[model samples]
Structures are given as structure tokens and as C-alpha cells.
Target: EDYRAKGFFKEALVNFVALLGWNAGDDREFYYLNELAEKFELERVNKAGAVFDIEKLNWLNAEHLRAKDPADLIEPLKAELNSAGIDFSGRSDEYLKSVIIAMRERVSFVKEYIEKSPYFFLPVAQYDETSKLKNWKPETGPQMLRLKEEFAKLGENPSKEEYEVALKLVATELNIGAGKLIHPLRLAVSGMPAGPGVYDILVILGKEETINRIEKAVSIL
Candidate 1:
């Protein structure tokens, strides 16, 4: 129960424990429950005591998560989000699917989707201190305000490329590298040092939300 709460799927847990005392005589580490039933052999059991390796279980859990379709993860993820008191109201299943696609590789557990990137479900409560120091600058407020104007120019349902082009135009107009705007923009929207591509985050958040977060950052940070 504890492991499931921590995002270990039942299949992953069963697969990991099965290998602790036996092998199928190959390099394969992943197996479905049915596969395990077919492959288990008495002669393959190890003579030495098996160690409970939590790290290996974590890896297997991640593998299982990656193997699943993003849509398949939505209900379980929603349950976890509700348990954690995350309000995903007004967000669609497609929106959640985009988040899963973006964050799946970055997280090993289901709960980590909300834990590592709370900005997805809620507004930026606090900015990352280290990110603020590195990405936000004294002149960043005015620069972000200018960037916000460019974002405001975008139509509804803008593409990732549109966001990228807008940022590049802002950088060119300021006579600075895009990184100047990119780093600060990422800090403004995600409140994290890193995650997915900045443009991807912008696209997922949509034009209004993206511009709003920038305005908030400019005012506060």
C-alpha cells in the first residue's frame, strides 16, 4: 500500500520481487505477470539470500510508467492529485495527457507529477531561490513585461514554434541572446530551475495563462 502511494505500480512491485530470488536465464529484467508465470523455473532459484533493493524497484516502476500510454495514466494520476488536494478543475483530459507526455520521462512515480511540478495544477506559490538568483535579474522585470507584450500578440492556440519565435524577436529587439529572456521566462512560468523545454511549457499553459504568469513574476520577482 505504501509503495503504491509512492507511485510503484502493482505489476512493477511483483516483477521486482520475483527476480530477487530467481532468474529466467536471460538479460531481460522486465516481465508481465503472465510472462513471469510462464518463465519461472525451480532450477533458476538462487542459493544465496536475496536482498530487497528499493532502487531496483524504483527503476522497474519507472520503466512500467514509460511503457504505459499517457491516457492510461490519467485516472490513476487524477486519484493521486485529489489525494494531494490539487485542484485540476477546468482542465481537460487532453491537457493532463499533454502534461503526462511532457513529464513522464522526468518522473519515476505517479505522485511525482504533482510533487515536482505543482505549477501544472496551481499558481506559482513561491519561486525557486536558486533559480531566481541565476535566472532573474534586476532588469528582468522590464524585459519580462516586454516579453509579455509579445506573448499577448499571439492568437489563441499558438504553437510551440510561435512562442519560440516570439521570444527570439524579443531577444533581437533587446540586442540580447534569447537565453536572456528564455531563462527568466522559464523561471516566471514554471518557478523551477528546469523541466521541459520553455516553449513546451508555454504551449501547455496556453497564451493567457503564460502571459499572466509573466505578469505575476514581473510584479513579485
Candidate 2:
């Protein structure tokens, strides 16, 4: 019951448990309840105790999690956020939907999805120190500052493509790799070294907030 409350999907659980003592005489590992029911046979059921494999369960859960529609996840996602003591107020439906889209492929559980990106809910107070030490350089601050200025010119609500184009243009102007700016910029906006595509995250965060974050990161350096 606690596991269910923690965001394990029912169909995924069913699919995993059914495979415990039964194999449908084939190489396939995934099947719906109806499909398993049609294939179940008393004689074919293994008499030995079946060991539970958590990896298999997680794999099944991942598939089910991805198959779900983002819209259907909103209420439960809000409930999870409330449980975590994160205020869901002021977040719009469109913003929440964008978050779901950003996170869908990144998490197997709803709770994991919400917990993995707290920056989505709150301002990134500080970046990951290791990422900063590894990725930041003398040129990083100035380049990001320039990138921030470029972003400012885009007006509000630029598409993800526009953000990428601006970043690459700045990198080209500077005659350095875009990665020099990108790595630090990611740390700035997300406080983590990796996440969904950088521009995708920027589009979701919007121009003003994104540029402010870049400026903040430049200040940090």
C-alpha cells in the first residue's frame, strides 16, 4: 500500500508479478493482464519459488510510466508535491504540462520525477559544487553574461530553437566551443550538470527567469 502511494503503477506491478512463476513459452517479457490470462496454464506454472527481481520490476515500471499521458498525471503530481511540502500555487497548467513533458522520459516513478528537479519548484540557491569546479572557467562568466544579454533581446517567450540559436551564435562570436558556455549554463539554470535538453528547460522556465538565472550564475563565478 505504501508502495502504491509512492507512485508505482498498477498495470506495471501486475505485469511484473505475473512473470514470477510463468513464462509464456517465448522470449517476450511484457504483456497486459488480459494477455497473461489468455496464456496462463496450470500445467505450465512453475512449482519452484520465484525470486523477485527488482530490476525487472523497475524496467516494467519505466515502460508503463512513459506510456501514460502527461495531462492524466497532473492531479497526482500535485498531490505528491503537496506531500513533499512544496507549494504548487502560482504554477500554471501549461507550465506543469511542460514539466511533465520534460520529466517523463527521465523518471520511472512520479515521486522520483518530482524529487529529481526541485529547481522546477524553487530558485536554485546554489549550483552543484563539483559541477562548478569541473566546468567553470575564466571565460565562462563573460560568455554566459553575453548569452544572458542575447537572451534578453529575444523578448518574452522565445521558442527552444531560438534559445539554442542565440547560444550558438554567442559561442561562434566568441570563437570557442558552445560547450564552454553550455556546461556552466546548465549548472546555472538547473543546479545540476545534466537534465532534459538545455533549451527545452529554458523554454519552460521562460526568458525572464532563464536570463536572470544565467546572470545569477555569472555572478557566482
TM-scores for all candidates? 0.96, 0.93
Instruction: Name the weakest run of 10 consecutive residues (lDDT summed) in model 2.
Output: 1-10
RMSD per prediction, one decimal?
A: 1.2, 1.6
- In model 1, what is the error at residue 217, expressed in angstroms? 0.3
lDDT tens readout by residue for model 1, 1-221 = 98776678999999998999999999999998899999999999998999998889999999999999899999988998899987888889999999999999999988899988888889988999998998888999999999999989989989999989988999999999999999989999989989989888998999999999999999999
Q: In TM-score terms, which candidate is top? A: 1
Residue pair clashes in candidate 1: none
Model 2 lDDT per residue over 1-221, tens place: 76577577888888888889878888888777778888888777788999999888888887887777899788778888888898879898778888988988898888876678878888898788899999988878888889998999896789988888999999999998888878888999999988899888898888888988888888876
Q: Give the alpha-carbon lDDT of every model.
A: 0.91, 0.85
List ranges where model 1 is wrong by over 4 Å. none
Candidate 2: residue 158 Cα off by (Å): 1.0
